[model samples]
Target: MKTALIALTTATFVGTAAFAAVADLDSDGDGVVSFTEMLASYPTLTEEGFSAIDTNGDGVVDEEEMTAATEGGLIPEA
Candidate 1:
């Protein structure tokens, strides 16, 4: 049980770290992620793909959008 708990905790930490890494890519610190900023981190992602993630036609991906994309497997699970 202890081992499982430790593993869960570690996974949570790693997931949070990954999210933070992506969040840190917001060079402008606009509280939202722009395509250019996301592209800087994920070179393989295209503008169209980013559009899908943006979800609200806002031209930016906010934290809720990012979380939904990640959770729904629209983006890779971290």
Candidate 2:
């Protein structure tokens, strides 16, 4: 499953019309969402959008940023 997402890492991306939970996408249980991890939930999320959601530019999206993205109309709400 993860490999499939990785294969599409550089593919065209956009927002999906579904709600994605951080817990569900945190496949490694690392407390932060990596690009591949996010792909599972947001199959069409672009690298640029992920960068925006990451906020700190740490290559990972934390809970606070996820909330902000959804609230700010960047990502769809649950």
Model 1 clash pairs are none
Q: List where candidate 2 sits over 4 angstroms from the true fold.
A: 1-20, 76-78
> What are the lDDT scores of the predictions, listed in order?
0.77, 0.70
Taking the tens digit of each residue's C-alpha lDDT, what string does model 2 give over 1-78? 998897666332212212245666789998778989888767788899888888899998777777767667776332
Model 1 misplacement above 4 A:
1-22, 76-78
Q: What is the clash tally of candidate 1?
A: 0
